[model samples]
Target: MLAVAWAASGDSHEVRLCVTDKRLVWLRDDAIADRVRALRLAEVDEVVARTGRVRRQGELRVRARTRRRRLRFGEIAPGPLRELAEALAQVLPAGAVRLPAA
Candidate 1:
C-alpha cells in the first residue's frame, strides 16, 4: 500500500493506493466528510482520456473538519496520473486496463 498526501494551494488532499486481489484500489478524501471513497480505475481512465490528460481526481470524500463541505478539485500532473493508471492496469483483469498513453 502506498499513501500520498499533499496540500495544494492551502487545501489538503490524500491519496492511497492499495493492492487488493492483485488490483490497485485508490482511496481519497471524500471532501464531504472525514470518510474516504474508492474510485473505479475505469472511470478515472475515462476522465483522464476525455480531459486530454489526468486532472485532479476530484473530491473523494467529505472532510470532517470542514462540516461536510466539499473540497475543490486540485491539479495533478499528467505524468503521475498516467503512472497511477499503469499501476492500476497491472491489477485489473487482462484487457480491462486501458491506459491513456496506450
Candidate 2:
C-alpha cells in the first residue's frame, strides 16, 4: 500500500482507505477478519476530496465505472488523502480524479 488513512463509515470497525499501486482499497475490520473492497485505478471515474473545517476532519469519495454508488469515508485526514489522491492521479487516466485547489 502506498498510503493509508483512518476512515469512518457507519458502524464498521477499524475502517481504512488504502492506496495501492493498481487499486484503491477500503478495508473493514470485522469480528471475523478484515473485509476488503477494491477499485482498479484504470476503472475509476472520479475522486473527490472535501476539506474539513474546525469541527470536522475531512471526507474522501471515490466513484468507479463498475460501482453504482460512490464509496465515501468521512473524518479522513487530509494529508494522507491528498497523498493518496496524488498517487492515484499518476495511475488513473487524466481527469479521472479531482482534488480541491490548494
Candidate 3:
C-alpha cells in the first residue's frame, strides 16, 4: 500500500508511506531525490493515530524502544491513518497483537 500525508496548511513536511510484506518504508522527494527510509514494523513498539483539533487531519507516530527514536507522520487525513495504523498493528509480533473491535 502507498499513501501520502501532509499538513492542511502546507507548512509541515510531506511524506509518502509504502507498506510491504517485510517493511514499512517512508519516502521523501525534494530537489530531485528518491530514497527509501526503512523503519520496519517489527522495530516499532506501537503506532498511534491522533486527531488534531480542526478535523479531518491527524497524526501517526511510530514509537520504538530505542532511545530518542520516533517516526512521526502528521497532518494526515483520519481515515487513511486509521487504516494504516490498524494494518501495522496486525503485522506486529504476537505479544503485541491488536484486533479490531467487532
Candidate 4:
C-alpha cells in the first residue's frame, strides 16, 4: 500500500509517504492536524492506527510543519528496524531522493 502525509502552515508545508503490506498512518502538522484527525476519524484508509504504534505488516508515514521548516519521510521498509531507518534516511528531504523542478 502507498500512503502520503502532508502539512501546510502559512506558506510552507511538509509531506511524507509510506508503503507497506498491511496498514498506513499519516500525521500532519499542527496547522492541518485537525483536518488530518478528521480524515483519520473518517477512516480514510482501509485500516488506520493511532500515532506512535507500529504494526506488524503495515507502514506509517508522518509529516509535521511549523513556521519555518518542512520535514518529510517516505517508503519505510519492513524487516529489521534498522532497515526501516536506512530506508528513511534515503528518502528523507535531505537524503538521496531528488525532486523535480517545477
Candidate 5:
C-alpha cells in the first residue's frame, strides 16, 4: 500500500483507506477482510477531492467507468489525501485525478 488513512465511523469504529498498486480499498479497521470495497485504478475515470467549509478537512471520491455510483472514501486529513491522489495520478492517465484549488 502506498498510503493508509483512517476516519471515525458513526459507531465509534474506524474506517480504513488503503491505496495500493491495483485499487483503492476501504474497510473497517477491525474487520480488514470482511465488508471490504475496492475501486480499481484501471477503471477509474476521475478522483475528486473536496474540503469542508468549516474544519478544513477533506474527503475523496472516485468516479469509475465500470460503476454507476461514485465510490466515496471516508474523511481524512487533506495532506494525506492529496498525497494519495498524487500517488494515483502517477499510475492513472493524465487528468484522471482532480484536487481542489490550493
Candidate 6:
C-alpha cells in the first residue's frame, strides 16, 4: 500500500508498506529510481485499519515507537483494504489487529 510515514518529530515521507513472512516493511518510493525498504515489520508496534463513511473510505495505520505509516482510500478500494487488513493481521501478533466491520 502507498502511504506516508509521519514521525513524532514532525517529519513525513512517502512510503510503501510491504509485508513479508518475517515482518512488515516500509519502502521509500517517491519518484526515485529504485524502491528501498526503510523499515521492517519488527518495527511495527501497533496496526489498525479503520473504515469511515460506509466502508468506502478507509484509513490504515501501522505505527512504531515514534513513527506511523498511513494508507488512505484515495487509490484503494474496499476489497484491497480487506485483503491488506487480513494480511496485516496475519503478520502482526495475535489480537493486535482490528479490521473494520463487514
Best by TM-score: 2
For this target, which candidate reaches the highest lDDT against the unseen true structure? Answer: 2
Tens-digit lDDT track of model 6 for 8-80: 1112245455556565555544536555544466666766776668546556666666464553323335565
Among residues 3 or more apart in sequence or in different chains, the pairs in candidate 3 whose N, CA or C atoms overlap within 3 Å are none
Q: Which parts of model 5 are misplaced by more than 4 Å? A: 8-13, 30-33
lDDT of 2 by residue, 1-102 (tens): 787888887657468778888888887876255487777887788988877778456777888788888878787777776887787777778887787456
| Residue pairs with backbone overlap in model 5 | none
Give the per-residue lDDT of model 4 (tens digit) for 1-102: 333433233323433334333322334443443433212212221221222234323233333332133333322333322343334334343433222211
Stretches off by above 4 angstroms in model 2 are: 11-13, 31-34
Pick by lDDT: 5 or 6, better one: 5
What TM-score would every model get versus the actual structure?
Answer: 0.41, 0.82, 0.70, 0.21, 0.80, 0.61
Q: After superposition, how far is residue 85 of candidate 3 from its true place, in Å?
A: 0.9
Model 6 CA deviation exceeding 4 Å by range: 1-17, 26-30, 66-75
Q: State the displacement of the C-alpha of residue 99, model 4, in Å, after optimal TM-score superposition.
A: 23
The better candidate by TM-score, 1 or 3, is 3
Q: In candidate 4, what residue range of length 10 has the lowest lDDT sum? A: 41-50
- Report the alpha-carbon TM-score of model 5 versus the true structure: 0.80
Where is model 2 poorest over a 10-residue stretch in terms of lDDT? 29-38
Q: Rate the local accuracy (lDDT) of all candidates.
A: 0.38, 0.77, 0.60, 0.31, 0.76, 0.56
TM-score ranking, best first: 2, 5, 3, 6, 1, 4
* Residue runs of model 3 more than 4 Å from their true location after superposition: 2-12, 31-34, 94-102
Query: Which of 2 and 4 is ahead in TM-score?
Result: 2
Alpha carbon deviation, residue 97, candidate 6 (Å):
1.1
**lDDT score of model 4?**
0.31
